[model samples]
Target: MGRNTRKRRTPLATKAIAASAALALGGGGLIWANFYASAHESNSGQNQTKAAAGQVATISCPDVGQKLTNVPQRARRAVAKELANLDKQITEAYARLASTRQAQTRDANFVQNSIVGPLKEKRAASLDRIRLDIQRVGGRVNTSGLGSLAPCTTQPADQTNAGGGQNGNGGQQQGGDQQNGDGQQQGGGDQQQGGDAGQNIGGQAGNGPVAADFVDITKVAANVQGKPQNGGQASTGSFTTKCGVNANKNHNTDNVIVAPGVTNGAHHLHDYVGNQKVDAFATNDSLIQDQTSCQNQGDLSAYYWPVVRVQDGTQDFDQNADGGGKEGNVGKILTPVQAEIKYVGNPQSKVVAMPQFLRIITGDAKTTTNGLANANAHWSCTGFEDKVQLTEQYPICPQGSNVVRTFAFQSCWDGQNIDSANHRTHVAFADPASGACGNGFKAIPQLTMRLVYEITPPTLENGQVKNAYAVDGFPEQLHKPATDHDDFIAVFKNNLANKIANCINAGKQCQ
Candidate 1:
């Protein structure tokens, strides 16, 4: 065997050495490229701090065997695909992170403002989970310990288009290969549907009173100022009719003109100039007092005559204005000296169905040493002799049954606050005025009336009532006839009452 054996070819050895040398060079180059890429992308300046971190240089190598050598191309393609997937995941994570940050900021602001509660805490926890996911991905990138030339058996497939623009084998896969596609599609569809639904929701809003300048007189009667020839005493009451097309089912309210009568039976027996009384009576019988009777319509205080604000379809205000500003945004009240009532519907003099009963409480009475110093009396009059139904001035909502909720009303004298050393004393209108003993009388009847109109649940916001008044009427720009009192009151009362009722139903107690 020794005689037959020949020395191994030096040329073969040389070729083997060359191949090994080439492999070493390629491996070193690849590792260098990988490390360079990582360093360049590192947030902590990995290139500059590599020595401090005790990290070795990196190089990439492919299998040498023919069967395995085809791996570089496969590996390159896989790395590209994995990188693309990672990019997509990172993008989604970043978006989620941004949302979480925004939520956190809002929660922080809420907590600062003392608005944070259990709901806010739960939201914070959800955001924290998203943040933790971001941190976890970051940790993997920073703490991985694979060598530069190490071959990753589980390397994700590459999805890149190389020079030939060819994708890897089985790269044309579809369907389940795409992750979260179904979820994203569904989410997008739901978002669009929700937006469409929101667009369909309707609301009622106005810059100011809906019908401010409109007015109408649906009825009228002659006033002789004194006892009639038939011995029928002169009175301050009128009948009315209203008509309208309720297109939107909005609320409405109305008010009527008032004529004052004497507290005594005689037309002009005693006259008072401020605090002093006059002696003689006027024989012309042309004298008329400006007063009101039938105060406190049920639970409500009183409905104002000249100008009254009806809210949510149930309550009436003695004053021309309500507490809140135009849209009822602020909880502020301002009492106005005067107001103008505008009829809501029926611009033409069209007669509508009128209320059946008409009741008038005339302010007339006599006073004696009966200890009723600030007390006044009223006479309930029904069925006027003149059945004339001319439209100009008439009682709109006569004989309407109602209810009221009474409680202590303490308003700031200066409208600033309920408490302050400079603030004025709080007056309880329910109680008799202080110092009422010696100076004739110190108490005045402060009770008022607010009208209520019965309505169904569907009529209101899903049918809820918290306030005594309802307000309904025409739009703000419409012009109404000058003779429609009934229409105006009906609209205003319905609108105002509904608002109060809704507020009450929502757990806000009446004041």
Candidate 2:
């Protein structure tokens, strides 16, 4: 049987058909069927051609069923692999989205708690530092032998103040509980007083020094061709006065009045040398208590004053009064920028105006350094007549006079009976709890917002003048404050609300 067996040959025509079918259908059965067709064709001329065709057809019949099963199996495997890939891609995309959302939330929360919250707290602390530093400087005696002292210009960096700057006098302590209800229990009329000789009035009891030749806007008539200069002292046309009416009218929108004694004290420029101590101002008189009253220092001239407003049964001129409202009477303080604007008048006016600069000086040093030494060393004061080399670092009063202390001043604190320890609590004058926001201390977040906005757009709607961001809303006079602190609290709250909304709308811009 092996010797008789011959190899089966594939016909060309059948092979061509099977190869074509395989190329089109991609199945082994199709290729085999073509081969069978070719084999039947090859046997065509013989007597068994018809029988061969029948046998070839029968031989390829089973291939069709096998191809159907194999095609379906391959398709199922490919579909399963494709489905698995889709699921993995979907999972990764979802995870990435979730992570992005979480990161955004964390960032938003950090800005709110770390940046905004800390800013608010620092604003309060800064106000305290200003007041404390002023008190420390005022406590010294005029060792420089000049009638007037000078404002402190060299403010130590915050980091250097590890101790309370000078003899435990510049640190903050936990205050006691505050009073409830509107701090303005009584809204009686405060008796008006006169300004010292040459003082610029910031508050009612203007503790800051003054000069008579500083020029008065109201007194200088528009029709007058040539205005008097320095009260006709020299070639300078500066005319200064301690006019309470003009000063009051200047900062009336602030709801604060300016009087003599504080800003209008006796002005006699003197120098504070290093390594010396000056006598502290009299505690009995609130007007001359702080260096804030000093008119000149180096390139900087500070005009210090005490704010007076309604409080409880009595009236207070100094801003140290507390316990006039709930939540411990957090009184808000005005910033240096705001204060400068009120005292210096409009910057756009044709009249020559001084620069609006506010520098907050604070430190904690156990021993006195160069700047922390006596008031004489703290600053050097010069006047227009002094033939001294006008050093930019030395303090100079535009007018060569001190803001005089007057007895009849209405806004001055009743310091005749009160001492330093008790004068702060005598009466509610500038209660932080009833000031700009709702606290007496200054709120920095609100202040920053206000300043930034104003610098961008100096003009606001209506005839209202924008002073400080100490308040929240764009307009400063909207809130109905029961206490001084409410004004500032309202502003702070408004600013925060706006910031939050912006963050939500603009994604990361709020930070």
Candidate 3:
């Protein structure tokens, strides 16, 4: 976390075509252009780029969880625990990648031999245990190819995934040493001290949230379009719940829904607004018995998301902690000014009451490497809501306006399971055109959450970002905006749940 903690790094000299301009002028405001950052030669950076052909920014491993779709229910807990271990392995490898910048510049093979190789071996061991657990429970799973996911490759800064995921529009990457945009772009970084101009505007821990990761909202054209609708009997009402925006500073780095039983599973700090007892160890029974932050005691749902930080030199309480600065996630955590939690009706059918303890995760936590497949976070500034909503680029708002993040969760359920092995698959989105649920899926009241924050906008003049802000992420993810995500657990009382269904079905909005 020190500026000169290791001197093997030369300044990151970045050259990017102004992705912001090309994106704005391209289509009817909805045209999303990819932001590609390529490493090039410059007097200050040429020697360093040769170390690994580019600074070995982070490690990219195939997402094993996305592939293990059939682990039996009896084995899910054990499988999830192993999955968390895989994330820990990646975090440890990335930490080595960041700390050994000097050694990397000396021997090009150091990374593969010293870091990646050991990582693959460790992952192979965990994967073997996972396969055994599934087999023990009579679940059909891969016994051979599963080990292939163990080998992780290093990703250069320029090749980071930045664009092309559905939110309200596209804003963030793919690979190629070739140039692809039309204008010039720069990035932001924080000097480990007073948070002024540092090495590059890449970030606080010297990884990312680069200039291309953000765009001026005023430059983006209007792109807010409604979902397709077909005439049919519809439930048009909504139910709103009042959960204060985590004023008590209920923060942690745990994710019970995904990596239960593992501490620091998230590898980044998260802000919680409801269901005070939720943590990496919380069980469904414990959740039902926990306290609530909602105004209505009947609602004890758990809602949480990654914390955003302003990289201006100040340190957080967890600066030296595991999921904090030690893992490359440093800086001050900003609390939201407003957290709007609402449930709305389906346009094509009456929504059934969601079963208590149902779990839903919207957006991909590792979208920077996972591709745009599960990316679903929408970012925009207050007054410019109708102009643009971004998935990759964080919106830079004008004075008086704060940042807004919206998550519209899946609205169709598989009718049986409350959860699945992947924490997905059991829930899904209705048809965007007709609002029809998939076969065997039942329409469920959709939850839409909007979070607002007020951090002074970072300056992006003279090719450097001062006071950059970014969401906390796994060390390897490098704080990319495309990685923003959210989680929810239904804990409503049975009577209250029925009332919600009744209200929505009757087309009556309720609070």
Write model 2 residue lDDT over 1-511, tens digit each, in one string.
0011111211422333233334323522221211111111111211000111111010000111111111122232232222222222222222222123224244645323533344334333433332343335443222332111111111111211111111111000100001100112111112111111111111111100011101111111111011112211111111111212212211211100111112211111111211011112222122122232112211112222222221111222222222111101112322222121111111111121211221111111111111221110011111211111110011112333221111000011222211112112211211111112112221111111101011111111121111111111100011101001111111111243234323322223222
Per-residue lDDT of model 1, residues 257-303, tens digit only = 11112111111111111101111122112111211121212211122
Q: Which one wins on lDDT?
A: 3
lDDT, candidate 3, 24-71, per-residue tens: 435324322222221212222211111113466668999999877777
Off by over 4 Å in 3: 1-53, 163-201
TM-score per prediction, in order, is 0.17, 0.15, 0.85
Q: Count the backbone clashes (under 3 Å) in each candidate.
A: 100, 92, 13
Q: How does model 2 fare in lDDT?
A: 0.18
What's the lDDT of the predicted structure labeled candidate 1? 0.18
C-alpha lDDT (0 to 100) for residue 49 of candidate 2: 8
